[model samples]
Target: MKVNIYYGGRGLIEDPTLYVINKIQDVLKEIRVNVGRYNLYEQKNGISMLPNTFKEADAVILAVSMEWYGVGGLMQTFLDSCWLYADKQRIKDIYMFPVVVATANGERKAVEDLRGAWELLGGRVCEGICTYVSNRIEFETNQVYASIIEKKAEEIYRIVSHKAPMLPNSINSCHVEIPSAGIELTPQESEQLSVYVADDSFVKKQKEDVEMLSQMYKSILGKKSQPDSEDDLLKKLEKAFNPKEASFKAVFSINLNDVNKTIVLDIDDGKLKSSYSSSAKADITVNAGKDVMSKITTGKTTFQGAFMSGLITAKGRLDLMRMFDRVFVFEY
Candidate 1:
């Protein structure tokens, strides 16, 4: 079946909403489903035309987010453009679904706004998945968020596979639940964690260095490569974190007491050669245990928001800590 995924909102390299859409596409491919994506941001200035090929699609999913309790302006423009297309062709049979990314706190309002938009467009709302990422915290690692998106996508697929019709009042729902246990540590445990003080002296410099390192990796890996295909890059990053890798040495002095208990990473070979450290003095560290961290490195999460919310943290050199920020690419 032909499927088109649409993205609407202020475009940002780090936004999780777009990340979820990309994840859905990955899941669909894994199941051998052919799907295409159209970035509303890219199409905003173009002649609004739904390709004849798209018109032939079995289904078209409208994936959007309600930003600030209202339809995001970019999304609004995209929806309006679709009306122009709908007028030119009869698209009444194409199945439509609304996927809304919202925080646990703002979900209700987000859903309400999305429903209003669909009604305005005379579009039927099929299954709706409300993904909740904690706005109060940084979701640096994909962990819970990735799982939620995959599960939601699978649910949507199941519904589509069965040829399920939109229920009169049914807005099927799914979400990621925040963990109940708060992260806590003892003084000694804290001491074992990595710490990088972002003092006023070098915080901005550190951010810039991290951005440059990220760009360097992107250049070597090619900007368009998918995260799943970058095992070599992941392996290189893994070796760099190993203390025995003499070609590289750890560049920071992490104070475990000041950061999250664990640091998971995937590094490149050149980067490993230049910065591997064995006695790296990390309380806990691992490589690619979760798919989401790869997404984070690829710029799926906002750097400032992720760090500020502790989604990403570091020990040792504040400068070295920022290197992880630039590694992953979000292919939504």
Candidate 2:
């Protein structure tokens, strides 16, 4: 069996919590158990990444000193990190024993807080050691207190060896609701990200990069989704007009099928006049989709080529129909 102790006290000379955990550790180790201890104050820089140590632990002793009111900041940070980075399945299998030593009042409340946190974390919680020791030296020197500590440690060993079950309570039923983040990670990736988060320099550099990217994106202007005007057909017609030297006279009704627009072109003596009209009489009526008209006007295809490809149909004289391309030739 393996048990790990997490000491969150500030290592003060007058801290009685340290003495209790040390005595407990000694009793547990006397039974030939693999034991380890992590002092949070010594490794404060990487506290966020400490949950990775839970992989091999069968049980954990969360020992904290209550100098003031609540559990210390170090222990709270460690618990927050476990909630963020620890594997939920692994946590469900590990047992937690809380030890809260109080110099002031509120020892019972702090113990309840510790157990509540462990229950919320989906871990099994065993009965813990909570006491008010105003005089550290007296608490440490009392033979009766030492015997009680040793017996509790042996009880911890028996609980683990027997694989005791945790009773289901409302606190255990309440699920942990983690806040949403930008990206999701697997267990391994979450551990790695926690390490990065624990490093001040890494987090600072990442924030700087993100700010730069945000400004870069804000400075760029993208094209609008909708066009500003709806006069593309007329504009193309006006731009593609090419006057002829010969004297020619013709009236052409060009109907754009898709757009439901008809363009009437009147050609007389090498001059051209255009108008949009629903009723127009012409020597030739050309019918085509707007795409075909755009292709012909843009010099991509000619009238004769389009007619042979069945892209356009005309209802008038073929001679005048062939003359349609001559007066309105487009340059590249």
In the range 181-224, model 2's lDDT, one tens digit per residue, is 75466686565655432334543564575566445334421312
Q: Model 1, 198-218: lDDT tens per residue?
A: 234343553475576456445
CA deviation > 4 Å runs, candidate 1: 51-54, 87-90, 103-105, 119-122, 135-142, 168-332
Residue 203 deviation, candidate 1, in Å?
Answer: 58
Lowest-lDDT window of 10 residues in candidate 2?
Answer: 221-230
Which candidate leads in TM-score? Answer: 2
The local lDDT score (0 to 100) that residue 281 gets in candidate 2 is: 62
State model 2's lDDT. Answer: 0.76
Instruction: For model 2, state the Cα shift of residue 138 in Å.
Output: 1.3
TM-score of model 2 relative to the true fold? 0.55
Candidate 2 clash pair list: none
RMSD of each: 21.7, 33.0
